[model samples]
Target chain A: MGGKVAVIDYGMGNLHSVASALEHVGAGEVLVTHDAAVIAEADRVVFPGVGAIRDCMAEIRRLRCDELLRSALVEQHKPVLAICVGMQALLQRSDENEGVDCLSLIDGEVRYFGNPLTDSEGTRLKVPHMGWNEVQQMKAHPLWAGIADRTRFYFVHSYYVAATDREMVAASVDYGVSADAALARDNLFAVQFHPEKSATAGLTLLKNFVNWNGQC
Target chain B: MALAKRIIPCLDVENGRVVKGVNFVDIRDAGDPVEIAQRYNDQGADEVTFLDITASHEGRDTTVHTVERIAEQVFIPLTVGGGIRSVDDIRTMLNAGADKVSINTAAIHNPELVRDAAQRFGSQCIVVAIDAKRVGDVDGQPRYEIFTHGGRKPTGIDAVAWARKMADLGAGEILLTSMDRDGTKNGFELGVTRAITDAVEIPVIASGGVGNLDHLVDGVLEGGADAVLAASIFHFGEYTVPEAKAYMAARGIEVRL
Candidate 1:
């Protein structure tokens, strides 16, 4: 069989939508599996999550998806894509559900976008940060291939990634705060937005990710 | 830059077909739901809302086949409503590829449905649609009451107050439709729309009574809506989505066009 694409499912996130998206992007034999061996055997792995971080981490630990993801990125050096809560889980900790510890794969923290979210002009912006917004590439990366700079992608989240290292922030978007929209370090790439629902730009990114070889 | 005020084209679907009429009378087929959704996506629609008008009466779930078809071709955010009553229903739609689901009658009947759905799914995927009309009273406050069953029955709840309650109940957004102005083409009921928008912190989608491009401008500028939703104008070929966006952008309102 050709190299398969595995989408790690810990029973959270819209696994169906992500699988459908991966299939649409011509990922070729996309498998949504909780089995570790199957995931490890795949050439590329995708870890996607949604909903609260507490429950997300609970299920991740339950199914040992955390270890699966770690090995995929650290040991195998395979191209691993983390999306939304999946991206947040890669960080050290998150201030959601009061506070929750994360995988600490990346040296960053996930924090709430505090109520009364407003731009510099003091005008209110909605939480959940719904709808499409621009993401400007911080540095060139393989995943950003074929995608233009500052292209709009669909975002639906309240918590955002705050990395201490500017070098890790591969792309940034202004959502009241200049947040890191996408992060890249070594073989790992994660984005706060839902590329699956991003329409043309989103689908194109997924296609690029499927074709991407773990490179800087 | 600030987030652009969205312009959405809603499709009223029945028996898996897009239908149009004035106040739900003498319904006429507009086009296929999947085809219409793709056309809007190509025409630069900010988002699309599909209201399955027959699901409730038939005592069935959402039109998943149609939603799946639309989701395949149209890539933007899709929100499906009508007969979305429970968490399972929400999951079914999301599984079929809808980004969000709007609950109206069910949410009003079972307010916990909103909280539960928001908790199970993320609040971002839960939208509480409140179809309302101004209840002119003799002795009490002149408040807008919530209407369900295609605006056929009016609940005694106040529209603005219920909006605040739904936002508090974990609804990520509010889809506000004015029953009085729905098919009259007079424009959105600005007073009630602004009232609900100001009352809630979440984004509010102002729906119903969009007859022209100028009405869309008014929905955002005067009504204080985060988005403007219309069907007849866009369906009847009165104005293309991009053309409407251009009209709004020329008037100094931000749009994705």
Candidate 2:
């Protein structure tokens, strides 16, 4: 329940709130930093982002944090969390901005949750998918520890993750179709939902992330 | 699964402190903003809105600091409104840890502000708050106009049309407050609320005129708002957030329980 948690800030996220959430969850020495060296040394790295994908990928490449993240994941094997646009950035490409390249850290593509979105039961759903939805756990992972299955989590996004490898998808929630909600591979865990802004279940998930061992 | 309905608690603060005296309840001196926010969060409030009712220029800074304090304590979605005029104001509040910023009069003056904020910070963070009052009847039918300056200056703009325009301009949500029902504690103006809700596809938070628990239920059931925001009833502790959720849940409303 305690470890140095560094939130990767690229000038376009709710960094302060994410850092505060970690602090509130009893994490030790939570730091919101863009310094590659600081993020490289932290016990856990949370790459938090909001806004558009074009600007997000632009900033990630501009600051060379992309390279830092590459090494952090492949070389150091640190437990890393990507949220919202941060999660989108980890994919190969996104349909946003008419098609933008991404970090390709995971086996997925960032796609727009089509206009006139509707759920499985033929019920109409809204774009942006703002608010809380129940996430069905697809795999038993440590990050979900202390959290009940199908607990609701707050989300605010217009794009969703479409992963090619089904084994890597840790959870998928239905909204028109079964949308991949969480992707887990090795030390990397990326979620389309904002854990910091989500209520009790969110807090518990972050607490679990802080205490995770980065094992499968 | 359908998205759960939200319960939002609105706090009107003046000069950095929460303006007390709701009715028949003790809060121990207006209760600290941070403490009150935490209590609401624990009570299962989906979101908490802070309205800076300070007229003085200096009170703006006080509200900003209060948002900073409350943000550190409360983890749920925190929306800060009142006196938000420009993109800089929105950025300042966001940096201070507000998840979203609600704009009123300024948006009316410069309608482009909503589009600008939506483009810059995404539509999910921009909440266009419309204060509406029913104008003179036209042929046995009621017409609502947008009001500003504490609901004093009438813009003569149709509320339902403005709500549609706000959504067209890329606003994520609409916070509709009825001037007639505000502070009345009678009930929400479902006629206007449903009109706006039906006109726009975006999320709408029906605010004002929440007296009893049924009023909250009516806001969602009758008005069809995505969220319900109440002030006095919650501020005075007439009913807790969970109690309201339970009430709504029993009525078959999908709320996060």
Candidate 3:
């Protein structure tokens, strides 16, 4: 039987597109639902978000998804993927929202792209760093199974994860400093960028997640 | 290490569908906005730009409903433009779930609109779009001229200088389109893209004249564009987003693939 993939829908994500992407990447079955029972039965889970981190976390908490998500990642040890704000929600805290604690899957905080770097001409680079950017792989992981180093991915976030442990970072991308792009610890894999929006390399990553053997 | 850049797919929407043409003529129907957008979203498009090409000509409000519909379906960011002549229009799109609003004709007419939008909605929500063409000057400088009114009117304004002005006005991003190379599939106007990229502090999204993946890569690497936008190849299914990204990655352009 094909493995079941559950995409958490807290009424904040683009559920249709995420489901379509997972299905396209070879997920045997994709379910976009917030029901606890369905999530508990899934072989793998995905958390996708597009809007504010504060609101997403609020919805997850409202639906009591935080506890279930923790169980899935920490106890069940099912492969989990977090996209964009979903990734930020895996952090400890976010500056965007004061005192907002993320799922704490990775030890880090999210901060805005503070103070633009001036070029030789003394012009301040723009903030919110929207558009396609390149990321350098920091270590090998199944999430990046078919991707190479220096791969470009589509990004649109203003805040990024500042993981305390450098070893947890699977990849780093240059915005001003080497910002953590993706993180991994055992079965929990989260990306600051949207793999669902990263194109083929992203699809490869999703395919890898769907096919991963649950090894760190 | 810089942050990962984004790759955006722009759809020139008329009514409720995506449309494109050569030199803005003989506009051919592309496809359903939602379907095409879903395809891009699935293929890993970082964001999508929906320009209401006919809103002004038709004397209607911006395509807020269409933007809302697309936003509801896609999880990635959505930027809505075309006929965004006033701050009210920007607010309407944002309320409908647009992450950003692109101002082209309006900003060209009233330059302060950029600043006002930035002040009201934060700079990150404002995008100034410029359609430029290369014109020969008397001094042989080969200057870039800004075009307004859906690229039919010439303002005699220097493209590079106008980009600087927009930045001064607090435009969060610049969507720079090359009128000459648009839909020609020859490639983007590298000189135009580079000039704007060098002049603007904000991210520059290179639009117009993307025929292949190499053109996309050139827009980012050689043209200095943070993101590349195209419609024809993507609408016609010539290349999927993943395929284009893979091509860019293969060419050392640093795509997400």
Candidate 4:
């Protein structure tokens, strides 16, 4: 799949790993840019970010990436993938920084994993939930093509997404709580985990994204 | 299933070459850091960490170059530690494609560096590496003190309390190493390991003295660590990463395999 791929960068986090991962998988002409014209010309767009939601939204709005992404996902019907904080930014709001408004592209809100997060056995679970965890496919989608069910993916975040529209959730994972792992609606596919840093399983997911054509 | 505990194989690099110095003495060359990282990645290692022990300024560039090659090929979480003194150092490593930068002596020198780096790069990329050793007993409890300069200098800081402070200051994870047990192959200092893991809400990577695969499991089961790190055990070809994971999985511990 040697098509132009645009990786949206708004200075919120590192783009090296994502770009390199895409290139490593032979995804053609991976461009890490904030330029709207380049993104508009690309066959696909990857919305990737890390850090706090408040700062992410600040940059997104400042650079008018919100409008760019809005056009890509809402109007153009292009295949768009959002990752980590990039996924959280698509929600209506988040509990971080005492609450911050998001893109509302998907009907959802981000909730913290709790200060003293505990399992059913009353054992305290770590925050940042940083490690590999299984992603159970909730609904069938194109991206899950070659990937097996319950494949482990790398995750690192303090908050998790809860979509108001349950049908949008494509996969779920159990931390201290059952959290939405991947959400899908039409042409947009977003994941709460970093597929780039997730190794083979992650590379397979990104490869599926490269080959997907905005179809269910 | 819940989050699987990670088994990280750490590489001690000097001048872009992997080296293992027992207790900071009698160093032996292992291989290329990039090659070693890829081998571990193939064997299903959860993540790879590079501890740059290069003391010379000229040799430091090689470490960055080594990280660049590994990040380009190995698509896993890569952490670079050792001699990371400032925010610029953190940025340099991250730009070179490291997922996290672990700061050890620097965090003790300027405690604010931890907070500053976390705020600048986000907590997910900031790791505070604590090299501590048992100092004595305090009220019938084993007391540990933070050590810097390759476990030669004492900071007079409480190990458990310092882990809490680093977490509150915005460290994403803590790489806790026991200097006493580092090269002895006796296993981790479980007492202090459990103490720090329970003290903080963030994830902790237990390091030092992983003589065998059982020590890896013990680090998680007994020490309550979110992850366990070892260098020589995997580096010396004594055991492969898949074998370690299988051992842990057979013992009823959740692993990726």
Candidate 5:
């Protein structure tokens, strides 16, 4: 059941890696495009980004990805998957670079992990939180199929989301403080980790997304 | 579970081929960079690092092609170091599908490159690699000076201070290699590893001088390193990446096992 998948590209981050992973998972003919017409015609869409929120938003607007994303999720109701900074972009605002506006697909604010991030043991943890950490599944969704309850996913980000709507929290991770790892509403699923680089568990997640029919 | 300490298998490439050498001398071929990298990925390597040891202009271009081949297949995080001199070099590698590019000689020459690269491509994709050698003590304290050209030349910059400076300059990680212990199989230089790890808020990847699995564990627990990188032990098939992870996990260290 391989179908077309579109990976949004707005001159932010490495879009090729995302496209390669999708292709590797046999997700049909994956297209990394900025054209709205191309994204509008795909069976599924993957929104992926990296770097600063302000710059990401700037390009998202410059390329009109913001409007495309809203229409894809609201009007078209296509299955949308967002990764890393792409997930943070779906929030209302962010604390990075002294505050920046976001896409606001979910009612949330992106807050920095803060300087001197420490655990319960009082040991200081590193910023960017770069490494493999377990994501505790909060609820069962189609995306969590065949993956364990606390499978590890690769994460590299300074700020995290604090969603106002608690039900959107699909998964959570504890890194000094608990942060939302994955957020889901109906057709849209967003994660703060890099599943493409997360090894076996990550590949399984992509496989699940490929076959999901946009039904919870 | 907490964030697992990473185990990265470093491949030193020359002329687009993987090689293993002691202190960059008496070098011998290992295997194809992409094939070896795929084996490590199957063995549960947290990340893979490709250090292009090639020096010639044509060889550097070959290294880029090699990186592109590996990035197309290996889905895990891939870091390419050596010969990354300009923002264009970093951009080329990132565009070639590298998750991160580690800067060494270039960062020493112009520290602004770190800031510029980080600002342009985000801090998460930029890693500053420090090749440090121990010098004489100053006021009853041991001092480490940065070295370049494969640890043959010395730069008067303090290793710890440089790590702090690079972190402040927006570097996301530090790949600290001890020149004295590199390729010695004596284990990591825990002293300087802990020193730099504590000095910077960003993650430090303790590299060079790993012989056994315990050495991998020590780099994390004793050295305070967030990750450990080794070449020979894993290259020659003395031990696999999964063996190293299982060894670290059994020692009460958090690893993705």
Candidate 6:
């Protein structure tokens, strides 16, 4: 199959790195573009980010790429992979920006680090949880192909998706509580970590996403 | 569950090829950084740290070129250090596709550099590298001193205290190397490693004295290091990155196996 991966460049994310990584992993025609027509023609789409959730969503809205992306995922049934803040944008709303609405691709809310219900651990655990951490795989999925049981992906984010349904969650990690690290439903998949920065394991995951058989 | 430990291969560069041994001496060319980084990336290295040991004195930063080249080929995170003294330098490296920029001597000389970089680019982009030596002292306490100019000049700063201070100053990660044990291949300084790891809330990468896979595990489990960094073993192809991860996995250390 002729595969063209369109890396959405909405002006608020690391577009080049994600494009380079997909190209390195042998994706045919890794295009970095904000144009809606270019995104519509691609076989797959990768939304990569490393900044504020609201800012990224704003850029997507400004470029009118949000409707294009939403249509691609919901109507076209094309595979969509969201990384880092890009994944957070899949949530309905984020607490980071005071009730800013996300794309609402997944049924969840993005809340900041630290549990308001329980503060027994104190404030030692800083916000924007950075560095390598383990994500426990939940259910079997094509996106996790070749990934080990407890794969450690590099995460750098302050907010997490409190997914509404357990079935929609693909993977989770402990950050004071079991939080959704990955979410998938039908043709859509989102990860809270930077796969381009997660090294080989991350590359393998991306490869799986590109080669997924749509057997979700 | 415990956080998965990272296995990193550090390359000390002079000119373009990888070099080994302490104080940047007894150097042997270990191939191009692009080639080596690709090999490590293919073999599943969690990340790669490149120390441009000669960039400062050469009055030029080769990391930008290195990052540009490797960024074109390798997909994993590439952290560039050495001779990074200002925000402009960090921006140049980041623009070249570096995931993180590590500052050692500059962060020591001016602590605000760390805070400034972290503020502008976020803490995830800032990594503070510390080189320490085991000085013979009372109570056999291993002091964490900062080594500069390729581990030539001793900064005399306590490593543990410095690590805590750097974390407070907005350093997202600490890349701590043992100057005394570097290139020795005997083993990592567990006491020195633990002191810094325990002192700081951020992740600590233990560098220096990794002879085999066992040493990597020891550095993580015994030394309390979040990650282990090695040069000679990986540079000389004594063990591939997969072998190191496999070994760590067998030791029951949570690694990306």
lDDT of 3: 0.80
Preferred candidate (DockQ higher): 2 or 4: 4
**Chain A TM-score vs. truth, each candidate:** 0.97, 0.97, 0.93, 0.98, 0.98, 0.93
Best-to-worst TM-score order? 5, 4, 1, 2, 6, 3
lDDT of 3 by residue, B1-257 (tens): 24434677888888887899787787999888888887888788778988888887775443766776776567666888888889888877776767788999889789999988876665667889999998876486579999976578899999999999998888888999999898799999999899889877778989999998889888978888888898888888899888887887787765544
Off by over 4 Å in 3: A97-100, A118-126, A131-134, B1-19, B22-52, B55-172, B178-200, B208-224, B228-257
Model 1 clash count equals 0
Per-residue CA lDDT of candidate 2, range B41-151, in tens? 999899999877553244467788889998897889999998898998999999999999999888999999999998888888999999999887889878999998667
RMSD of 5: 1.0
In model 2, chain B matches the true chain B with a TM-score of: 0.94
Candidate 5 structure quality by residue, lDDT tens digits, B1-257: 69999999999998878897777776989989999999999999999999987742445678878888898889899999988989989988999889999999999889999999999899999999999888989898789989988889988999999999999999999999999888889999898999999999999999989999989999999999999999999999999988898888899999998
**Candidate 1 lDDT by residue in tens digits, B1-257:** 65678888999999888996577665888988999998998898888999998888775443888888888777788999989878888988988878889999998889999899888888988999999998886376567999887788878899988999999999999999998888889999998898888899899999988888889999999989999999989988989998998999999888775
Candidate 5: stretches off by over 4 Å: B55-58
Residue-level error in angstroms, candidate 6, position B39: 2.3
Worst 10 residues of 3 chain A by lDDT: A118-127
Which numbered prediction scores highest in DockQ against the true structure? Answer: 5
lDDT of 6 by residue, B1-257 (tens): 54567778888888877877554677777888999998898788878888888888775546577778888777667889989999988888887888889999998889999998876666777899998886667476655677776678987888788989998888889998888788788889888998887787777889888888888989988898888899889888799888888888888987766
What's the distance in Å from true for residue A181, model 2? 1.5
What is candidate 1's TM-score against the reference? 0.96
> Candidate 5, what DockQ?
0.86
**Model 6: interface root-mean-square deviation in Å:** 3.2
Full-model lDDT for every candidate: 0.88, 0.85, 0.80, 0.91, 0.91, 0.81
- Model 3 compared with the native: what TM-score? 0.68
Error of 6 at A210 (Å): 3.5
> Interface RMSD, all models, one decimal each?
1.7, 1.3, 5.4, 0.9, 0.7, 3.2
Compute fnat per model: 0.38, 0.51, 0.34, 0.81, 0.79, 0.38
